[model samples]
Target: MDPSGLPDFHGLPDSPVPSGAHDSPSLSALDRRIAGCRACPRLVDWREEVARTKRAAFADWTYWGRPVPGFGPPDARLLIIGLAPAAHGGNRTGRMFTGDRSGDVLYEALYDVGLASQPTSTHSGDGLELHGVRITSPVHCAPPANKPTPAERDTCRPWLIQELRLLRPTVRAALVLGAFGWQAALPAFAEAGWTVPRPRPAFAHGTRVTLPATDGGDDLHLFGCFHVSQRNTFTGKLTPAMLREVLRTAAEAAGAPTRK
Candidate 1:
């Protein structure tokens, strides 16, 4: 771990870092570091440019324009993984899946299944909370055209790796939003001492993969769900009921109690 808060995790091992380790920062501290990262020049330029060029619909709003961190309680039992932040969505609101149509769909389903406190996530301090699940993306910074380059994705890997290490203690199940998220999570889990499948598990709706845990942790239950993007939602590929079912199943697998 880098004390200076650079993306350099050169000497850190793959296993979970002890909770109160002196040299390394905690999850909250790491999140601050993630927001301040300029390691990828391309990403920094793009996100800032988007912020500067205000969207017509959001001309009165101030954009956060930085890397968004995972949202939810630190002791969550489930993790929700997404691909990357949308330009005007997370880039504007500074919270993953917030102020976007995708978030509207996702949070609504999460609420329906008793995972999210509210049915919408409009801003950072909108009083919205996730019950037993935390949400994160493989790429923290919003990318151009909603697509992050291969180099950018690899450069951002260490952040996700570090986050997984911190969350490993309480995270017993994971709900991956799409193929990209599934692929991104596999390496992070493997690096965190979870035994991923040899050939890699194929991505499909409702797919489940149980990973045997190392480091004295419990086995991780993996669930696959289609992303809550408008492309899928409008086309009827991923419906509200479909997403709710998957989320509820993940919560059940993790033994998470429902508030609803």
Candidate 2:
């Protein structure tokens, strides 16, 4: 294991395994390892810095200050991939996409599709549950200015790669939230033994791709949706109705049986 306590995948070629990928059967155990990661010095420094110097609105709140982990059931069939945690969002709330405008938009959409137990994700233990979806990111920690260098992203690839390996059996499809997330996920899918398309699919507002199974398992479907960031939402680039339709499609594709 390296300084991040992760088995270094840096030595591998043609593989984008998350540095933290390992043989842990329980996602909870994997999450614990993710929380302890300090693989990227720049991100490690930046996330902790924001935690200590919190915004005025959350001045009294204690921040998680560690790598945020994927949230939802272990046997989830639908996976939602997004960019890294927000400095004051998941970095503060210890849950993916929690305590932020992004969650406000995402959870609301998930609820519309009957995938979320609640319409709001305020904190880690808020009693919110995702019916058949699991949420994760390519970068586990909050990056500086919300931008992770290519090297940082590669180093963190193993965590998500391993997550895919564990969930492949049940995960029928994945919803990639943005171009960054789309890029991050496709490579990891290839690394996790899925047969990616010859010419990689281009990303768009509603792009869809099908990845065949190499291990004789079920094929995996991929969908694209504009990120639910404030920049997009506040500007009307991605509205509630738009997001709801995408989530409804993704959930149903994953066999969630969501009602229209």
Top model number, lDDT: 2
Question: Which pairs clash in model 1?
Answer: none
lDDT of 1 by residue, 146-193 (tens): 888878787777888788788888889999999888887798889877
Task: List TM-scores for all candidates, in order.
Answer: 0.89, 0.91
- Candidate 1's C-alpha runs over 4 A off are 1-24
| Per-model tally of clashing residue pairs | 0, 5
> RMSD (Cα, Å) of candidate 1?
7.0
Per-prediction CA RMSD (Å): 7.0, 6.5
Weakest 10 consecutive residues of candidate 2 by summed lDDT: 1-10
lDDT of each: 0.82, 0.84
**Candidate 2 root-mean-square deviation in Å:** 6.5
